[model samples]
Target: MAGVYDFTAKSLAGEDMALKRFEGQVLLIANTASACGFTPQYRGLEALHQALGPRGFSVLGFPCNQFGGQEPGDAKQIEEFCASNYAITFPMFAKIDVNGNNAHPLFNYLTNQKYGLLGRSIKWNFTKFLVDRSGKVVARHAPTAKPEALFREIEALL
Candidate 1:
């Protein structure tokens, strides 16, 4: 099976990013939106990144517009919004689809590794997948799951 490190995605800056850079680190891979009701969760996710980052953990944000057009922005806009509003310091990716035939390869592998409550397809923006240090998808979190609530699971992996 393809692991998280087997894929690459474009960063918000438009540079191709190889996931191998994150190998051996616990990861919270989240599909995000800038204007959604759960947008505030960015703060908590940033906090998690700051608190656990020194211990081989990081948060990867992938902005998506698939859900209600909430993340309608170009790469620069998305980057600016995240920095100005949430002060996000973690890596943010270019806009991508989380569902359908056009879905990014990384997201396809993620949903395949761990099915959500609704099945393999992502249900909404902010849907999160926890990848362990070995690059396996360990858990799938719903959009409603708070970032702070994931501390114990992340700590266990670390």
Candidate 2:
């Protein structure tokens, strides 16, 4: 079976990022937006990255505009917004679709590994997928699931 490491995504800077680089690290992969109700979650996500990054844990943010066009920004805008507003230091990917036929491959794999409450399709922005050190999908968190709520699961993986 293919693992999370098998995927590669474009960074906000337009560089191809191989997920294999994060092998053996616990990951919190989240679909993010800039102008949504859950946009404030970026702060908590950054907090988690800052607090746990030294321990082989990291948060990967992927900007998605599929929901209400909340993240309707180009790479530069998204990057600047994240940096200035939330001081997001973790890696943020280029904008991409998180649902429908054009969904990114990584998200497609994620949904297949762990479906949401209603179904596999991501319900909204900020939906999170917790991946263990071995690249296994450990849990799927809803958009409303606070980043702090993931501490225990991340600690167990670490």
TM-score for every candidate vs. truth?
Answer: 0.99, 0.98
Which stretches of candidate 1 lie above 4 Å from their native place?
A: none
- Candidate 2, residue 29: the lDDT equals 99
Please provide, for model 2 over 1-158, each residue's C-alpha lDDT reduced to its tens digit, 9 standing for 90 to 100.
88999999999999999999999999999999999999999999999999999999999999999999999889999999998999999999999998899999999999999999879999999999999999999999999999988888888889
lDDT for model 1, on a 0 to 1 scale? 0.96
Off by over 4 Å in 2: none
Maximum-lDDT candidate: 1
Could you give me the TM-score of model 1 versus the true structure?
0.99
Instruction: Please write out the lDDT profile of model 1 over residues 54-153, one tens digit for every residue.
Output: 9999999999999999999999999999999989999999999999999999999999899988899898999999999999899999999999999999
- True-vs-predicted CA distance for residue 94, candidate 1, Å: 0.4
